[model samples]
Target: MKHLPTSVKCVALLAAALLPLAASQAHAATIHTQGSIQYVCSGVGQGSLQKMQAQAAKFNLGFWMVKGPQGEYLANVPVKVMQNGKTVAKFTAGGPLCYLKAPAGTYTIEGRHDGQLRTIQAQSGTTAHYLRW
Candidate 1:
């Protein structure tokens, strides 16, 4: 039997280590919105939001939402996730909170509730943004 070279062995090890990460990413959250107000049932819900949040943390992206003044979860708010001044995702809040999985970078998150437009910035990592309306 022939032994592999050191460089080839290192490359093979790296690929092996990264394979599971790629596979998990492929199974990561998929966001879908409907009527500009709500995420499709298949994509939005408490459970789904949790999954998205996990993915956002794993990918070093933004994830968070808007809330009411009295600490109530505000629903039906329209939200837009923007990067580089271009709208990337748009959806309506099905509950008081929503989850976003954006690329690791600066993002402008805008949402409207109770006739007011609220905007905030979301950063990468495990930080969660809770905007009050």
Candidate 2:
């Protein structure tokens, strides 16, 4: 009977352990927006969703703008989410938006502008809705 070399055995074990990691990497899907927000304000309106889309790109995140109720708009809203003065996520003005899918983690989401401030906890693959003023 022939015994496999120590190096060959180690290589085989490492490959087996890494198989799942390789597969997960390949299966990962990146969320992306097709275009910036560009909805006209027939009523309450936020900034261009297009702009949010563009901004989200910086974080490799997905973006969407929501419609305000009746006569409200999501304008000049700024969101700063920090783990400790280190901004984890910052949302620029112009969004009455929602996140359809997010990565698996705990996140603090805040929206503020025009004297109204709203904050919530974000979870993975959860939907976060933002209503405009």
State TM-scores per candidate: 0.53, 0.39
lDDT of 1 by residue, 1-133 (tens): 1499988898999999999989856554555543321222123453655655454433444334445556655566787777779887777755554544445678777888777888888765545676576
Cα lDDT for residue 98, candidate 1: 53
lDDT of 2: 0.46
Candidate lDDT (C-alpha), each: 0.59, 0.46
Displacement of residue 40 (Cα, Å) in model 1 is: 8.9
Off by over 4 Å in 1: 1-30, 33-69
Per-residue alpha-carbon lDDT of candidate 2 for residues 1-133, written as tens digits (9 for 90 to 100):
1399988888988999999988755433333332331121111233234443443433422223333566344544566544334455564644344443334465565666666766655554444344334
Q: Cα deviation of 14 in candidate 2 (Å)? A: 53
Q: How does model 1 fare in lDDT?
A: 0.59
lDDT of 2 at 107: 55
- Candidate 2 residue-wise lDDT at 20: 91
